[model samples]
Target: MNMLDYIDWRGDLTFEQDGFNEVDNLVFSELAYTDMRDIVPEDGSRALTVAQVYGEYKAAGIDQSLMMNDPLPVLEKAAQSPRFKDITVKWYVDKIDTEQHLQFAAVTFIISDKLAYVAFRGTDNTIVGWREDFNISFLSETPGQTEAVAYVNRIAKLTDCKLIVGGHSKGGNFAVYACAFCDKDISEKRVIKIYTNDGPGFMNEVAESENYLSILSKTIKISPDSSPVGLFFLSKAERKVIKSDSKGFMQHNPYKWHVLGAEFESADARTDPFINMTISSWLNTMTDSNKKILVDYIFDSLEASGVTSFNELADNKWNSFNSIFKALTKIDPNDKTDIASSIKKLIASGKDVVISEKQKNAEIKKAEKNKVDNEKQE
Candidate 1:
């Protein structure tokens, strides 16, 4: 079954939903153990509530190690079930932190015939929530090295585990971080391929670490054509990037990522030099000032008008969009009614405009050619 299907049918300690005949019951049982009864009403019908479940574990006085480590047995049991029928299957759940936030990662294992797969899910706030409150600038916190990371290390130690890791957004980032910081013995055991579907990267301090260097050989970073989270600065030891089709802000969503046919049909699925150059150019031009101004305007618009989301801001009678633009431009958020007109004039004047795609490619090609010529001259 697909990842979405697995999530949909996931109920309290069970998978009672239909169209799940092919999956093993033991797998469902193991998943069921992740349930928290208080999360859903007494109805007991909602999908697993991750934070609530984790809280229950905390209240029960389960030591972090036992709480985090217990998932291994559940997964191992599921793998041993007859339904796997000689297929290589494993289950693992772990917690990891980048020192800023605690993250619980649920990883599914399916290894058979040399093909290994790991599907991960990110818990916590959603991007839409962040976008609405977009004034936060860059993420200040990294997932801490709490019990979560230790748990992840335990799973990574599994012998004979090959590579195949996938996660949406933050989960993708966690998967990469785990693979990067794993103990050498565990690191050598698995991690052949990593699929970071539109996940954000760590700050330069974390991304360029010695631990990160070890796994740079096998990494695939994919981003939507016009992703917001994927637009931050990253320094990779090597280049292995994949491009997807979902342009504009829609690319941040996995549903959109999957729309590209088998997960890449609706997406461009290209690693074109031109695309890379265009992105680099924009990154170069979009300075911290631009980010701060835009984010500050978002904050002002939200605060001044008591608006919660973009939709609410749009619905408010304050001409919020223009107000935000004016705030960003430092002109006047509550100026004349010609907000759009003023913005058009600013663009025409080339004040805060980002570099164009064509210009970006030209610059990249010129740099490459210059490097080649310099080497020859030397």
Candidate 2:
């Protein structure tokens, strides 16, 4: 059963009875995607119960066109569940600055009297959000990352409660970043754990920092067997591979993640080596400046289409494509050429890696066969 089923089966049990498990962690992480900015206070001075947020959501109904995934079902489930019904939610903050290509959202869940979970919202379907995500490969910290660290520090100072920070997708990246770089004294004392569920990694500078090393043991990184984002950059923290029902990019969806009882079904290793290698090699080819330029140019082209969200782009496909095509014509010829050449090089690198791996496997087989033949001769 998946998380929804787990919630139904174990809903009645309190934290005291079941204790906080990985299933609960994932449920909270996914719930981070819920848009709670309207219902909860920004300063977090006022506390709203889970039931209240669920009621507000039901009254408002759903808007499927929004960039974020629908959180209504998860809200309803949480409201019904005794485990989460009385949880106090506050400090809801959602920011989307198209000019800066930034999308950052987060909320705090006070699960117990002394325990709180800070969840960072991942990249929504907004073109800006996706652009900010790509910026991570080049920028040391995006605006979202900076805001996340401040948010955590604010919450930590407000309450002495033990903190668990987590997020799914890009949000997961924020969670780790906040924990790694926040005030060392506060984080080292109050932050108990950090969870990154299928989130991308930071650039080498951040990953190799002394701050990251200090909290590496407290961090938990989980990726599906076919993850592309989670395997981005180098991860120095403990990693876990979970089974997913979906394939390719769809596996990145938290709903497709498989769970058995209280925990996710674990995989021995990542299932898609070719994808892993291809992405790694492509990223290796681009310098930080190149990545920054590519991300800016791509997002600028998307914006030129006059579409903010992926939904809008998909709905008006012909117009969006035409607009982007027109915008491409306005770009510097050298930049356009460089972009095309880079893509070709990336594709070639992937092909080369595949061929190299195949050749290495063949050599190993031949060597094994020769050893067996010599043994027979003896």
Candidate 3:
């Protein structure tokens, strides 16, 4: 069973009954992805209770199609639960800038009178959101992270309650950034835990910062066994690998995560060494500037297609592919060559890791065969 099932089973139980578990973390993290713009007050100076949001949502007769598809069901389920129905949700913020390649969203949930969870929205379907994600690899601070820090500080000042910061994917990265770099007084005194679910790590410089180290112990990082995004860059936090029903990169979806009882089903370790190796090798080979250039060109090409969201681009796959191909043709020859070469190197790295693993397995099989032969001879 996954988070939705868990909620149905335990919906009647309050935090006083079951206490907050990892399953609740996943629920809150997933809830962050909901588009709360309409439900939230324009000034965001006041908080809205979850029951109030649900009432408003139903009153407006807003279709599920208008909401983010994955989180819509989760939100509906959470709103139905007595445990979470009365939670006060506020400080909703969503910002996007195509020119700056920035996308950021966050909301605060006052789970109890004394406890609050600040859930940062992860990378959305927008091309700009994906671009900002790529920028994390090279830039010291992306616009999303900057805004996240400010948001946390603002929320902290507005309330004296303990804060739990968290997000899934890019949102997770923002949670970590806000927890680490927000006002030290607030982080030290009020912030309790930071949760990052399948979130990518920061650049080496940021990872080594004093701010990061200060709150490192309170950080809890969870990734699916076959995670690609979570394994990107350098992570000093020990990961709690969880089992997933989905294969390959599709495992990045939190809905695919397996849960039993009040916690996620755990995996002993990550399952995709080849993918991890290929990404690590490719990232190591490219300079920060070159990585930025390739990412920029790729997304710029997508923008040329006149599609803003991934769903739009994906719905018209052929046209999107053609637009990307045409845009590639328009790029400088040097950049084209570099991008091609980088892709080739990534492919080679994957091939090498796969072959190495196969050889190792073969050797193990041969050794087992020889041992059996020796036993027979004896």
Candidate 4:
């Protein structure tokens, strides 16, 4: 059973009867997708129930559909679910600062007693949203992440409940970051769990910090079997892979993930380690300066196509295609390598990484074989 199915079957169970689990975390994470700007409070003083949020959201006639992911159906069901219907929500923060290159939104869910789930909203289909995601590659600290820390710190002051910081996609990255970098007292005492669902990991500098590792014992890193996003940079937290009906990049969608009785169905397989290694090799090989140039080249071209979001770019694929390339020609060649040279380097790097990986695998197998033979002798 997926989230919607889980809601249908277990909707009647309240938090007291059935305490919050990983599945509920995913539910709350998706709840953040709903545009509850005015319907939800920002100061943590006022709050709204899930049912009320859905009512106001529907009454306001907000666009319920985006390019790929749509939360309307799940949200409607959540509003009706006993588990979520009356869940108190507050301190909604949604910001898209183009100047700062940040796209962040988050909300908190009060389940029962003194428990609160701080859910970070995943990336929406905005240009800046996707841009901020790529920006993480070159920049160590993003404006979005900094905001997450502040948001969590402020929210911590308002509530005494144990915080369960969680999110999907880039939001998951923020969840971990916020928990790690928030007030040390909160990170050590207040935070009960940190869930990052298919979220990318931090750079070496951030991931290796004492703060990040301080909460590593509480962090749960989940990914799909063929996950593309979850494998990037990776995390030291105990990682679990879930089965997904969808394949390839499409597995990033939460709905496609398979659910067991209450938990995600475990996968017997993992994605090609080679692909993840290749990506790691490529990024590690590229200088930070080059990464900036590549990112600017791609996004600047897309924006030049007279489109701000992927939805706008896809509405008329033919015209946007021509315009994006036209914008590329206007870029300074001294800043970016020629297409042929860049492609050649990409191919060469992949080959070298693959060969190196194979040699390492062979050595690992030989060592294992040697240990088995020694045991036989004993």
Instruction: Output the TM-score of candidate 3.
Output: 0.86
Worst 10-residue stretch by lDDT in candidate 4? 338-347
Q: Which regions of candidate 2 fall more than 4 Å away from where they truly are? A: 62-68, 271-278, 329-338, 341-378
Candidate 3: worst-modelled 10 consecutive residues by lDDT: 349-358
Q: Kindly report which residue pairs in candidate 2 clash with one another.
A: 122-171
Q: What C-alpha lDDT, on a 0 to 100 scale, does residue 281 get in candidate 4? A: 57
lDDT of 1 by residue, 19-66 (tens): 222122223223323423333232223322333344444566542211
What is candidate 4's CA lDDT for residue 193? 98
lDDT of candidate 3 over 159-208, digit per residue (tens): 77899999999989999999999999988999999999999999999999
Please report how far candidate 1 places residue 341 from its true position, in Å.
Answer: 18
* Residue 370, candidate 3: C-alpha displacement in angstroms: 56
Which candidate, 1 or 3, would have the higher lDDT against the true structure? 3
Candidate 3 local Cα displacement, residue 346, angstroms? 8.7
> After superposing candidate 4, which stretches have Cα over 4 Å from the reference?
272-278, 330-335, 338-378
Report how far residue 31 has shifted in candidate 1, in Å: 12
lDDT of 1 at 374: 100
User: What lDDT would each prediction earn against the true structure?
Assistant: 0.44, 0.79, 0.80, 0.79
Q: Which candidate, 1 or 3, would have the higher TM-score against the true structure?
A: 3
**Candidate 4 lDDT by residue in tens digits, 303-325:** 66666765565455557556645
What overall lDDT, based on C-alpha atoms, would model 3 receive against the true structure?
A: 0.80
Best by lDDT: 3
